[model samples]
Target: MPVNVYRNESLVQMETYEAEPARVDELVEQVRAKWSLLREHGYAGDYPIEVLRGNRNGGNIKVVEVFRWKSVQDRINAQTDPDYVALAGQISSLTTAEGTKETYTQAVRGFNHNFPSVGGVELLKGVCSCLLTIDGVVKDYQMSVKNGIVLMHRSPRMDLDGDGRNEMYLKILMHGGEIIQAALGPIRVEQNFNRPNDGIVKSNSAGGSDFPGTAIWRVSWKIHTPMGPVLTDPDQPLIFGPATVNHYPPVGTHFHSPTGPVALVHEETGARVGTLTPGELTAFDIVVTKDDEIYADVLNTPPADIFEVMEEWRNRMGDQEVQPVVAGATDGVM
Candidate 1:
């Protein structure tokens, strides 16, 4: 009797073999359940599926990797336990550790007295045009600005195709640091260039007059909130009082800082729309990639909105339902 099969690409079946061995292990478990349903929804991390068994050129398959790449510290420890509490509400009630290093030195000298200084042609046109054309080279870089994004730090070179260039190094902390975070420890670089994708050139910034199609460009100042001014130039109009440049919302919103993590937004329904109370904890949007770079987590930070960092991780046990997942999980819809 005949026997051939072939699936997804048609031919269904045409069997006849009768050599027992439990019917050839139930026909190799129905061809591994149709190749795991054509590798769960048909090919993505494309090409990589072996399973041979000698005969033709000494075969012996078992390869497997139709998609697999999760490192950046395994995606930043996938949200390192302890209900994360907005990353442990990065507070400083001055409980210990020298009051958490004197409350992180008065929260970095009162947030760098209104941190906003990356000029000098946006940091030398972001280190010679987006770190030598997308991380070809750029000796150990670093920068900071917490809870408002802008954190490049972590770096290394040669992207050997780990996407994220080399590994977890969050960029889009841009001001002229053209979309980096291309490499670090375990590999990353998934669709980088979160901004400045329109012509990308700075030749040291063409004297700012929109040369080369609006020359000297680079984004991610969180693009000025509200989804960064409706994703930059969504037909302009992001008017936020008092010479807006990052002092955010409905006119300064009375010095936004609900005791700890900042809050307030209505920049076109990213929601949370308002909050300076209940020990604030908003996150309508905040892009920072590394800890295994993925991007697009959105919501899941609720372990008590952060009461003293979930009481210091529930006094070191963590769990009152423990939450905070969504570090942009990019793999089979997280």
Candidate 2:
């Protein structure tokens, strides 16, 4: 058996058959044999090909076969091969022609693989827009990310489609508490928002120099980190240092931590950039070529020079002083 890994050519095909009641057992065996043949000829991926059986209307048998093609050329090669063609003819004969269906789709990252933990972060390695397309069909879906934060968590393993196999789940937490969940199967694709392109990246925040009071907005900024959820003081607004413009050299901005202990986390992926203990100042640098958000959590109580706790909330709640981000900067890409 080949080592389980995602195929580079992520094309997957799903075939559904409504078999005649009399030929249910034979059809299921034939489907398994077909997958075995495909794997023998290097036409199938290393992952397991699923042969799911169910009861259809009128006591007929519903058989669904899902498999990944090793490459686009391998899929085309199977269409005309003599042995494959003969098996396909046998399968067609077993199933009702009118009830047969097939679909082709591409898998993104986080499909057919399990994460080590329940919740972490996975940044978009490349650009993938909100609009998803499969086999020339444009899906009506949109997942936009503001401030480059994408929360991800895993759902409990269960048989979502009654396919007889418990599927691993990857759930993406979106803005406004909306969640996009996908099964770790061939057709399921994870939505990643990692592009800084002009058309895709949008800014919905608007402000002006109107005659508004300075302390209009004072809600505490809640930042989710690897340690846990850190909430800043509502009375004292989170202070942001001046942005360092990177135009000439085109390098990411350098960031330094406060004079006390804290933890630095990437806002997009939730990956820990670095940690700082007492008397440690340097944490990590912002490495994005475009605008992004990073947060710092004060691990312990520090001197007033670095960060101080609120009087009212501190007295009642005790020491829960988590400092806001030390660096929230934007850099230009050449």
Candidate 3:
């Protein structure tokens, strides 16, 4: 089976403006609305877009906005897009041209930033659930992660193919920014995109193993490691600062779960994973080992239990919604 490599180049843009003392708040809100318009018009970037306001020497406010361009073409398109142009006009009317500046920069790779440590041991946590099937027998799995690695295994080892032992196992390591290794049973594949050799580092860690039939895996997970938080939902991009809601499609064409059920059947054994009812949608990442072992990290939450989960939360919180207040001495002001 052939593998797919997805890559996209993005540019970070920084803009600064000076605003009159009285119009500072108004200018900031206008700039924010402008960014929202650009996002609504599909001109926003992949990473988080920031708008910061600070006090200048003369009491005039300095506003700085930082964001990434999805691509060079998107940057070009935004300049001509009517929605963006109109909003840009509104923003320019509120700023002083003397202090305005804009610059674009690209990231330099092969460098690691120092991340804060806790108790001298950096911990990575990933929480997810999976619907796993072995020999037509299905079971639900709630997976756990440790030290930036996800491990899955079957308990009470049973011989599904009469192999005299249990053989279901999987390990996913995401210590760095990208997926570096994935193992299914005896087969494994590894790669390091940061290195010059971007191809597979080791296609097979163990001796090749026979293909497993009709493996049904519905896994939804969020991995928080030293590199960053990894999300399966393509709609939610990773951000270093505050994130805005994005309902648009992901950066590129990656396979994702649909609104309805999805069923996969094996050609040879005629075995199939059961169909799911329509419910919440999640991202699907399918990795196939060099030995033809397949792992589909697609998670689908059933519709029937959605309300039950919500009700449980309501009960636990005494049917009250949690609200935030000022840190201290604010008399309940937010």
Winner by TM-score: 3
Query: Which residue pairs come into collision in candidate 3?
Result: none
1-334 in candidate 2: lDDT tens per residue? 1122232334677888887788989999988989899999889876578888888667777888888888888988988888998998888888876445465453322321221212223322221112211111222223222333333232233333343433223233331112231311112222222311000000111232111111000111233432343322222332211112222110122211122323433345555443222110110111222211322122111223221222232243333332322321321110
Ranked by lDDT, the better of candidates 1 and 2 is: 2
Model 3 local distance difference test score: 0.36
Worst 10 residues of 3 by lDDT: 196-205
* TM-score, per-candidate, Cα-based: 0.18, 0.33, 0.36
For each candidate in the order shown, give its overall lDDT on alpha carbons: 0.22, 0.38, 0.36
User: For every model in order, what is the number of clashing pairs?
Assistant: 21, 0, 0
- Ranked by lDDT, top first: 2, 3, 1
The C-alpha stretches of model 2 lying farther than 4 A from their native spots are 1-10, 98-101, 108-334
The residue-by-residue lDDT of candidate 3 on 89-112, one tens digit each, is: 887888877445565443422211
Show where candidate 1 strays beyond 4 Å.
Answer: 1-153, 157-263, 268-273, 276-334
Better of 1 and 3 by TM-score: 3
Tens-digit lDDT track for model 1 on 1-334? 1111211212111222222232334434443443344335332122233333212243322211112212224324434533332322331111112111110111111111121212111111111111111122222122112222223332222121222211111122333222323332221111124432111111112232211110111121122321222122222211111111121111111111112112333245654322111111121221222332432232111122122332333344332222211212221111
Those runs of model 3 whose alpha carbons end farther than 4 Å from true positions after fitting are 1-10, 98-101, 109-116, 119-334
Instruction: Provide the clash count, candidate 2.
Output: 0
Cα error of candidate 3 at position 113, Å: 9.4
